[model samples]
Target chain A: MIIDINAFLGHYPFRRLPHNSARTMIELMDAHGIDSAVVSSLHSVFYRDAHRGNEDLFLETKDFGSRFVRVATVNPKYVSWRRDLDEAMDRWKMKAVTLFPAHHGYLLSDVECQQAIEEIVRRDIPLVLTQRLEDRRQRHHWDAAEDLEFKSVLELVRQHTKLRLALVNWIGLDGKRMAEAGLQGRCLIDFARLHVLLNKDVDKLISSLGITSIAFGTHMPFDYVGPSLVKLANLESNPAIDYPAVSWRNAARFFGLEGGD
Target chain B: MRKIDVHNHVFDAVDQPGANWARVESMIEAAEWLGIETLCCSRPITGGAMAEIAEVRRANDAVLATMQRYPDRVRGFCFIQPGNGRLAIDEMQRCFDQGMIGVKLYNQFKYADPMVYPIAEKCIELRIPLLGHSAHLTDARSIAAQPMTSDSLEFCKLATRFPELILILGHINGGGDWEWAIKGLRECENVYLDTSGSVLENDTIEMCVRELGVKRILFATDQTMEGCVGKILSAQLSSEQREDIFWKNAHAIFARRTS
Candidate 1:
């Protein structure tokens, strides 16, 4: 069973996405053997107030039940973001929250951002940070999602030792740093951007970092599921690594799901 | 099904001293896992910056040596630094003599530059395809970098000048407006789009197949075989269309030098 920690719903304003609807998302997950996914809304990305998109996401995935778990977004740039976070937690029953600091034009070091993260920790919910929505080289000409500085994210992770964090869409050397920093076991990383294929780099990562801190995340709707699955499948062949842990066990455990499916 | 990867790099890391050879080995293993039959390998243009003619020769020689080591699995492309006019031509001749099949031009100079015309003429005379690094220019930052980079429009201009030369627009998915890139090169039949680079946007492969026929798209990984092949496999295309992009088109394009 595959549990995708990073998936999205709603339309990406710049390009055409194949599985933007809830139905198509489920179809894609089923086709790719993804049992469950933590989904955020792309509407949250473009809309000025992410609370509206969060509400839309909650309404959209509420019907699918356990197959799709809602991961609401809160743009801390808003003055009333704390109230929105409360509604997302208590009213929406979102399993986790996603921060688009870059898109929202705020630093992770901002007081509001730190307070929101502290609250997320207080609630005992996981916080997923999407480092980038699109490849830096291929961002849309008019408006592109700026990336959150890696050093800033590292600083946030170091300060909030009690917070459960997972970073998504980081690639190459940045991914290596995330894995190294995740040694604390409080933070985890999604394999979608790592592109760890069958190689010594992944092997070393599994051996040194431990497989429990790694989770499968497909940046779907914007990206394809095939590469993430292929990476997982390739890593599964090594006897030293645990495929179940990376694929679903770690995510299920982190999100407090029962039995890891 | 057989597959040919047109855009692949073979270089040892100068920054990370000990990691070079292992990286190359891992790349080959990854290619084998993806079932790629032949990889057109060249020394990455970005590596070592290719600032001097000697560096260019060293990079091409490295590719030649790699091709020799794995004759059946690998094909070499002589990377040229057009700024080194006469030396670049001599290196191209040397590479051809050493059984290199094609010429690889990177961001050293724009494809439309007068310095590149001689290289294009040589490729035509040698009956070899010229693989060029091309992307869509977005802003002033990219415009300033244009002396070393070529967008699809530049490639279109180059193709118009040399209609007989087979030009490949490498990484049509890399940056800028891909729709503009595709439309800009739509009239240039000699120019082909390489499906590589880091951007695997949904329906991009389908868009390429729709705009440019299946034969015009070449499946390439740009060193990340799994990621690249995954993009092709996930593309919503018919089996025949997949075959054409995966192997048939590449085979036809590369078969020219032999013919």
Candidate 2:
């Protein structure tokens, strides 16, 4: 079984996402042979009341059963974030909590963010962070959100030794840096944005971070599902790598699901 | 079905030099893994800035050697800097006659510049496609190090001047407002958009196919092999449309465009 560690539901502010609904998402998953996907609210990224997008995501994925796993985005900068995070956990049963620190106008190093991670860690849920949802260079003129700086991310990973952080749509990071920064197994990076062939970054990443730290993800609605699937294909073809860990095992374990190694 | 990657680079032996021969081998290994049959490759010398004519020729010679090494797998595109005036055309023709299939232009000069006209005309005379690098950006163009880079609007200008020129716009999805690029580039019936690079975004191929149609799109990776191919598969395209973009259109670019 394949689980997409990263996927999104809700309307993108700029440009049209033809497959923005849960129905289209399921269709895409079926097309790519992905059994499940951990989905978050794209609307939460733009909405000032971030929980409103969580509500939207809840209404959409609530009836879908286990095929869709909800990932709630909590903005620590927002005043109601403390109450919202608890509400998301208790009511929405959010399996994971994602933070768009860059878009939320805060740093991963912030006290507010640190507190949030503390809360997430205590609850035993993985904290989802992303380098970017969109390629900054290709962003719409209005999308001025800066990418997550590596130093801030490194800072957080070092501080929270037990925090399980799934980094989605990340680029340019290799295994060596992860080892040096002591960010290896604690952080799980998805392949939605990693170049499997061009840079052969996956080869470098697996060598340093080990297969367990890598997971499958597709930044859908904003991006295609096929890149990660094809990446899995490439991984399977490589005799040295364990394809199942990247394909679903790591993601399943990271999300606290069944079917993990 | 076979695939033709119309635009990618040869990064071995200067360009960055033989320091990266392993990289060249890895690119071939990737192409083979992905089922890519032909790689229309070049060695872009300007590196991201303007280059002298001699420097440009040296880079093209790298492509010549790469093409010779791969032979059937690798095809060459003689890279040129339009600012070099007649010398640019001389190098372009020299490489073409010596088996380079097309011309590759970077961001040193915009597409609409007078210097580009002669090169475009040279492409017309040789019946070869001209692959011009572009990025559709607005306020923060300087950050990308492509100050004078051509956008879709400039490509439109050049296409209007030389209707017969087989102008393949490099990497519509390379980076920057692709929706803007698609809408802005709609009128240039002759400018074929190579769906490459930022195929990261879903529906890019569908939007491109919708705006530019099947016959005007070509498949390329600009180094992002899986993303580029995946972009086409993600699009709602017919078999015929896919075939056209994959090879037929790019194949036609090399055949006599005097039609």
Interface RMSD of each: 2.3, 1.8
Q: Count the backbone clashes (under 3 Å) in each candidate.
A: 0, 4
Model 1 lDDT tens row, A1-261: 889988899988777788988989999888879999888999998899999999889888889988888887988778798889889888888888988887888778988888888888899888988877876555566665566667887787778777887777665434456555654466667877676754444555555556777888888988888878888877787677788888888898888787855
Worst 10 residues of 2 chain B by lDDT: B12-21
The parts of candidate 1 lying over 4 Å away from their true place are A141-144, A172-183, A198-201, B13-20, B47-50, B139-147
Please give each candidate's TM-score.
0.93, 0.96
Work out how many backbone clashes candidate 2 has.
4
Looking at candidate 1, what is the lDDT of residue A197?
A: 59
Instruction: Quote the lDDT for B119 in model 2.
Output: 92
lDDT of 1 by residue, B2-89 (tens): 8999888887632233435666677778888788988898884673264788878778877876786678888988899888998899
Tens-digit per-residue lDDT, A177-229, candidate 2: 77777867777888888888877778788789888898888888788777777
Candidate 2 has which clashing residue pairs, if any? A138-B176, B13-B17, B13-B18, B14-B17
Q: In model 2 chain A, where is the ten-residue run with the lowest total lDDT?
A: A132-141
lDDT of 2 at B87: 91
